[model samples]
Target: METDKQQKDKQQLYTDKFFESGHWLLKIRQVLIATIGWLAVIIPIVITVLAFWASFDPRVPHLWAYHEGIYEIKFIGIILIFAWVMTLIFAVSMTIIQNRKRDRIVEQWPTFNPINQKERKKTIDDFIDKRFGPKEFRENVRSYTVKPEQNLETHQIQELYAKKDLDDVD
Candidate 1:
């Protein structure tokens, strides 16, 4: 019979192999998607900041000559600001849509739902145990009985007083 440690080692090896097998492309795709998503959110903000800075800075050259006391730089800055706002709205909407799609997929396919799978649940439990150590439950020594007529605090106080009296007698 295999010892517990040996069994755990075997399971770990199996898990490592399972993750390594034929999933590198999927992992790369996930990383690329995450990077693109972050860039989509960040690029607009950076452009907006640069546009605002250019609009105020005297040293920066304007895109065109100022016409009728109206700075063309301000117009360009306003356009950039609008573009940034639209980009933010698009990113937020896409994130919400992606989340809803993922949820729908998980709901439709029970196999994709980890909570519904016993093996996945066991794997999660094992990971938790390994990461945080096994949960230690201590026995409850103080037991209290509360009647229907009395409140919980009164019952607990009465129990405490009785225990004190017993301690004094002893």
Candidate 2:
């Protein structure tokens, strides 16, 4: 049997391999997307500020001369608002779909429902007992109290104690 240290080293090796593999590409992609998203937001705000500054220039003949710049800002605002609304709608729809799917799954498998937790636990325990023989109780731990009327004769209790004493002596 492998020692605990060997088992731990094996687990650490697997974890190291998992992170060293293509997972770095996923991390890079996440950072790249986040950077691009922030740039998208920041670049527009900078442009809007510059446009406002240019619109206030006294050298410009008329206020309507910067009308295109104003229109561009308006367009960006509309796009941002539309994107936000679309994202909100997508999130709400996904939540509803997921809830319906979960409900259907729970209906199909009643054991998945929280109300049937005791039944689920009993089923798992039965499976474990069948797969591995019933788990042995710890030798010295008295998890449950044995009542006098439980049908064990005094001699049987004495024999059990005697066996425990012998084990302790060893």
Candidate 3:
């Protein structure tokens, strides 16, 4: 009942829906990255720099004092610097890992039309049949049935025979 134009519109609608969600996801990713950067990198660096500046005075005591003035390194100042370096490293490593995972997921994504899945399945089945033969083709085949321990009643035997006869007739 559908015309070519109608089919085209449906396909376009499906594709547009996919991309619309993709765009929304991208926006969310941007917001998350921005928020994480602020919390992890920017805030740490700011705090570290403030601590360093505040403790840069002559009154502040040093952990290991060698020379006076600019040469002195306070214990708290060293800790803040180390923390800032670690924060930067953590942010960069997390970004790299996230990007690699995103790439892997995108690469592994399946592309299939939900509307025409049966047709697609048929095409795949046909390819498999041509390449590997029918579903009945197999290396090892077995036929096994579970039997009751006691002997069946006479009626049960007659029913089994009747079922076999029906199968033969078919």
Candidate 4:
């Protein structure tokens, strides 16, 4: 029998395996997506700092020239700002789309739960053994005292089973 920890480890491995596409192109796409996400956040903060610095100080970097007196709005700053906003939107939309795709893929696959076919087979075999008795006496029910036969149809059988006396069992 597998221990709980071992079962959990197996489950983790399966979960990871399902998420990973294994293709080089898919891996590259994931890396690019992550890079864009980080850039979306970091670039804006860096731009804000640079804009602030350029506005307060006369010594502005060569990358950004003050276009107007409106708090150091430069051509480079505008371009960077536009790129940052667009990248942020792209990242969010792509993330949502990718998550939906992954969920759909997972739905198509079989359940990750570990199946105990052995245990189920053993239980079925034991029940068969008890119900049929020993191999030698299996086909010779006349040699042993048999329970009264209930001649019931399919519906009646179902009703009888449904209304069975659970309290009769130990």
Candidate 5:
């Protein structure tokens, strides 16, 4: 009922649709969390620098005597200031890198769902421990279900067989 060219055209359209959706989703996700990676790197480094600097001080009351000039600022102050500046640069670099990476992912695969990258692992792990998790995959293999739709196939197949097999087996 359809020509080869028509089928091919339809297929191409579908392919384009898929790619568009996938990449759109991917871009959305990369934007949301790419900075998270940079933050993870920056937060600990900043915390460490702060904690180390707070360990020592001029004691307080005689602080004015120590604050005479730049010298009172001390070696630790310089190192801390430098460290803080470096941390800022590192954080900015991380953000740029993440943004670039996200852009590339979207350009390459526009329809790739971004949510999968963030939630796939956790969803799978939870499904494994779920009520039906014990039956996930047990044929001498450790298999995790990626989505619930997978179960639909087995259910439909069983239903199809049950009607015939019920009378045939007995």
Candidate 6:
């Protein structure tokens, strides 16, 4: 049956694409992690350097890890730089991609059928006919006669009062 197929499709759709914590927030979190991943590398490198020099030289007057060899510092720097570059690239690219997606969603947004004068009149008439039966419907209901310049606030209150009056008459 179609219902069975639809249920199967629903189950498969979850496996096809993972939506976690809303799409935009997930994108934002990805960028944050990527950017902070670099910080994770850089901050430790800096701390290690500071701690190293402070350990040997009392004059340095700081608690810092200093790796003495130039190669070691260069290695850490290289590692930090790599982390920064990878995440920086990911962050910017993900932002642009998510922005495009956001725009697409906005562009494809659905519209609602607005309440208009004709529809409003029909809705009122039909509702009255249903509630009051034919004879009372004919006697009590009148065409909406608000001026075009009237604000929606008064129009809504007028509609509510009209419904209440009809109810009381019934």
Comparing 3 and 6 by TM-score, which wins? 6
By TM-score, the better pick of 1 and 6 is 1
Model 3 agreement with the true structure over 1-170: per-residue lDDT tens digits: 99988887874334443346457877777779889977997875665455455556655443333344223346556889999999999999999999998888866764443555565456556655555456676334365333463334666533543543421222
Would you list the C-alpha lDDT of every candidate in the order shown?
Answer: 0.61, 0.65, 0.59, 0.63, 0.58, 0.65
Q: Estimate, for each residue in 21-127, the C-alpha lDDT of model 1 and write its tens digit.
A: 68787788888999999999999666655555556786765543334324555677689999999999999999999999989986676544344356544554654
Q: What is the TM-score of each candidate against the true structure?
A: 0.31, 0.33, 0.25, 0.29, 0.27, 0.29
**Residue 102 of model 5: what lDDT?**
86
Note the residue pairs that clash in candidate 1.
Answer: none
Q: How many residue pairs clash in each candidate?
A: 0, 0, 0, 0, 7, 8
Error of 3 at 75 (Å): 1.6
Judged by lDDT against the true structure, how good is candidate 4?
0.63
Better of 1 and 6 by lDDT: 6
Provide C-alpha RMSD values for all models, in order.
21.6, 17.3, 19.9, 18.3, 22.4, 19.6
lDDT of 4 by residue, 2-71 (tens): 9988887874434543256676777778889999999999997777667667666878753354556344
How do all the candidates rank in terms of lDDT, highest first? Answer: 2, 6, 4, 1, 3, 5
**Deviation from native of the Cα of residue 50 in model 4, angstroms:** 0.3
Q: Write the per-residue lDDT of candidate 5 for residues 1-170, one digit (tens) a residue.
A: 99988887874334443346467776767766878888999986666545445445444233223333335446668899999999999999999999999888867874634544445445545544463445435444565556665454545533543543421223
Which candidate number has the best TM-score? 2
For residue 155, model 3's alpha carbon misses the true position, in angstroms, by 46
Per-residue CA lDDT of model 2 for 1-170, tens digit only, reads: 99988887874434443356578777787789999999999997776676666677866444343687777777888999999999999999999999999889866765434554565456546554554345675244557555455454556533543543421222
For this target, which candidate reaches the highest lDDT against the unseen true structure? 2
Model 4 ranges with Cα > 4 A deviation: 1-14, 18-21, 62-170
